[model samples]
Target: MDMKQAATFIIALLCAMCASAQTETPDTISSRQLDEVVVNVEKPQVRAEDGVMIVDLPGIVKDKPVDNILEALGYLPGVMNNNGMIWLTGASNVTIILNGELANMPLQNLYQLLYTTPVDRLKNVEVMYSAPAKYHVNGAVINVVLKTPTPLDGLQGQVRAGYNQAHYGSYGGVLAATYAIKDWSFDLNYGLTSNKSWSREETWSNHLYDGKRTIIEDDMRRIGHNWSNTIFASASWKTLKLTYNGQIVSDSKSWNLSSGTLGNYTNAYNMLSPVGYHNIALRYAAPFGMTVGGDYTCYSENRSQSLFKDTDYLLGSENRQDINRWHVYVDQEHQFGKWQLNYGAEYQHSKDHSSQHYGIVGMADNPDFDDILNEDVASFYVGTQRSFDWGLTFNASAKGEYYHNKYQHNWNFIPQLGATYYKTPKSIFQLNFDAQRIYPSYWELHGGTSHINDYSTIIGNPKLQPYIQYDAQFNYILRQKYVATLYFQYGDKAMVQLPYQSPDALNLIYQTINMNYERVAGLNLNAPFGVGYIWNATATANIMNRRAKANHFHDISFDNSKWIFYGSLTNSFKFSQNCPVSVSIDFSYISPSLQGIADLSAIWKIDAGVKWLFGKKRCCELDLKEDDIFNKWSPTMTISHAGQDYRMKVHDMTRNFKLTFIWRFNGFKPKESNSIDTSRFGTGK
Candidate 1:
């Protein structure tokens, strides 16, 4: 083995020895035996083959999912991927699925639907960055496993309704439903809300190189309306499984913008976005017991963005955008003695189209940029999961994908291996090594002028390269409960986002680029206590370094890169009364961000809610969520190329309150089925 492999193996060996005391069983956790959380989750974690934190969705939500969609995947730390869009990392892509089928709709629109759908509808939202044998090439995968039972021999259904309002007199309504027969299942859900929110901003900056300084202040008001809808179904006959998922979402927002240096009046900005999506999957289990599954997705997305500057040129025109993704996959798995073998092939095609009407300037030149995206891809994956007599399970998997996009066509094979060892009845030790390959997204390949707003123009790079990452993780579990994990990752051709100077624009622009290699290593630990008068609580801590494996930009004098620390403390509290109340506090600290180019900042966010129940099956709730409750100093500030000079933009918001209600008519207990509420199972995660 090479040096890297040899070093990893040595480290793994040392960890296995030091943490040997952790190898144990569930009973070890309590005087009475209790099962541990199992994170089967797409064969990703190498820590322990048998158990890991299962991002337990159902356990987190006391009520059925009819309350809110975010509740479906609320247990996962990485569920909220928002860096302006659905980005897994600060600058990576993300794709979501429901019932193993893709949600061919615009992601923004998808979030809208979830806003309408009750969380109780989802069985679970499985989040995994790695592509499993049964998955396609769509970055990370978010499988929204709908609620269901394990017995697999009956029909079940549930419908939930909820209402919520805010201090601003704004309110929302949500409806969620699911029906599953012996061989078929169907689901329908929606969420509608009208909200009033406002923002005030003050900026002070000096374009040192341009010999200019500007002081600006602006306050904006927005009455945002969001409507979301979802439909899904799945059928299984013996071993064959067929599935369908569809979503229709729309959001319209009105904003008032003003600037002291550039403008004096509050300018109104309005945008209406409509998105529709549909997908179908067909899977067949061969007579030999091996299974094959394929799926297709279609999306109809349109965005109309407008700015009201009150002037013809300043009167921002309405702009439109369209995006679509098509994917088909086939995979198989078989049992071989102590090993389970899996393999698969996948094909994908994606296209993005932008329609520009009239905006600031330059966007009128190209209505649709073909270079934005046009590609065909083929991929193959294989793996094996085996268990040892010591109760240790080893899982190894690999993937090779080929992409033929306009910018580049390349092939890469990524490999991963993991081992879980149980040393004693109360302990567990695990280790894993993974090499992942990532290709640039449509925008990364071609980001050009956007007709939407002054949100800087986008530019694409034809010379961009693929990202190859080496990931390692080590974990120690105690009493099948408390857990600690240390992770390290290095990447060559790592995708990084940097502001690119726009010579002809009125705003700053940041583009995704592979100008530098990055290496990051961090640690994560979680402690989940038993339920009590006080809700469960989890504590997490992490530190990561983004090293400059290589750099080329000279204007930016830098070497060695920068490091950042992330930490979070979460809690859940409940009232024993018929009504339940919950509260959460989130804080994120960034040490000057990567490159040490900016000042360090701390962000404190808070969310509080109360669920009032008249009985066991009926309830209503009021939720108050706000970012920067203290209206403290701005949380995030970045300077990028805007028009001819670099402009600084800071985002800070005040408190937002939302009240919600939930009600369920007779919880659907399978008619001939046991009324045993299995929902209460898996209490500890």
Candidate 2:
């Protein structure tokens, strides 16, 4: 047994003999007695139509102990999580889609498969900022909806394990499976994680080359080990579908640097990554009421990095990157009463290859470098949505695109708008607008360079350019649990990562530029309630203002303006109705922001969790968690404009303690999806 474990045990024994021959056929026992003739519906936990906004992840992880989906997206509401990158309040561009297509993978393997998936297999999470044109997305979108088990006639699954202690100590495991037999269904997932981390960093710099002014200081220590693996598989028969998601990562690091302007340094690094994506789909439901689909997607990535220089033995080089991607789509939708029509077409292709190999220990002319890139895109879209009888509703769209790269080629046309109004039945109002385009990634167009010793380095830019964004929003809802938003966004060429100052006098290059404008204006508030009878709550708030300009940097030109605030709160406690136990608490706060040339400071966090349940249909469970609890979650960066001056501080591993266990057997429940799958177009960034 080792032909890949005998081909995964002969494909799980031929899918359990095709689910035991469809339950010994008899029309699957009258279709399992007509699927138990049941009807139960419940939905609501934020909702808004047309311009989208829907969150109902089982009513927000009811009694939370949420495992995965990035800890349930930090409890929703405008979703923001920095340091783990995920932002949405006032959006600066974000995209992630799974059920409604587009999760093409990469972007650190989609955040390691959404932090190892399982949030009860998810179901509902959608937020779109003017993304229409039949979901041929643009600008902002989240959309994650899964859990579509629809009777596999039994055979459920779950098994998990976890343990963690920060400052070093870690463990992990997970295995999942689902099988169904009438109209066919099968799903499988595997996970593995390992970790060891510790970090500390400090830096200060001020340099002005050949005419004096040079001040530098540094202190650093980092020790690391991170291992990851995640895989997902899907198979569907009726309406045809196939899917796979993958992730693999291995990282190792050792660091020790003490510098007062380049003196002592010690570094060791290793990295390996493998990313994947695959999908095939087809759907139809047209006897005239239209609903058609088509999909194909494939993505790949191979990465490698190795660097070493323990003080001065020097010999740090070897970097590689490879990527391949392709995507195709076709879509159609129809509904002719209150009016709804959507259309789409898409195509995408990508290729990138990179290499760097430099050495001194056996140096044969020591320098080697290579980069290759290719990109192509084509898209078309049309959309319409309408409804009226006084309480208005309307949506519109038009999108067209053609882009190719090898330097440049373009064609674009995009337009979108939305409106909704309902003055009674709990009031509502909304409006949205959009025009967006963002491209440039593939290591920012693969013009590469990397090194962080002998004075820092990391540069890439293949004439990087492609940016255009304009967004607007106004939303209000009350009585459905209050929510309000007013937003604005603007961009033109914006793409940043600038920190130049290298003309000998001690280097500091950090490039990736294109910014002459950037903006954000916002307000968002969300409140969800429940008080008498042991808490149960949710709250969010964000207020913002930001501006940026990089005036064609020659050595970093700058202009940045800022005002920002953030807030969050989540609570749940139900002391006891004869004890099954529960508790949860979450808090967040952030203030101080001004990106471009840094200047970021305020940060805060607190998290807590506890849950326990007895066996017998409670399926077995246990959880205890703690994160950043009073650690004050540090994060600091400061950079003082042109002639350059900078500062940095970080202390990692964000406080931790975790213990988890879960087991489930018979009743697995995870199906439920009726249409909508575009197979994630061209994945991550």
TM-score of each: 0.74, 0.32
Residues 1-685, model 2: lDDT tens digits: 6699997984565455445434442346555677668454434577677667777865666578766676677577777766566777766666777777544554555665676667777888877777776666776677888776757447777787889898888898887877778888888878888878787878888777888877888777777676777787778777566666766555543444444556666665555444445444545444554445544445544433334444346555656656566666677778788898878787877666666666545555334567777778888888889978888877888888999978999898889887878857376787888887777666646555666676776766779888888888887877655778899998887888756777665788887788887888889998877664367888888888888877777544677888898888888775433345567888988888878767889889888887765466467778887887877788788887666777888777687889888887776534444122222222111
Cα misplacement distance, residue 140 of candidate 1 (Å): 6.2
lDDT of 1 by residue, 337-370 (tens): 9888888777767665544344544645544443
Candidate 1 C-alpha error for residue 476, in Å:
2.0
Model 2 earns a TM-score of 0.32
Top candidate, metric TM-score: 1
Model 2 score (lDDT): 0.70
Model 1: worst 10 consecutive residues (lDDT sum): 674-683
lDDT of each: 0.50, 0.70
Error of 1 at 511 (Å): 3.3
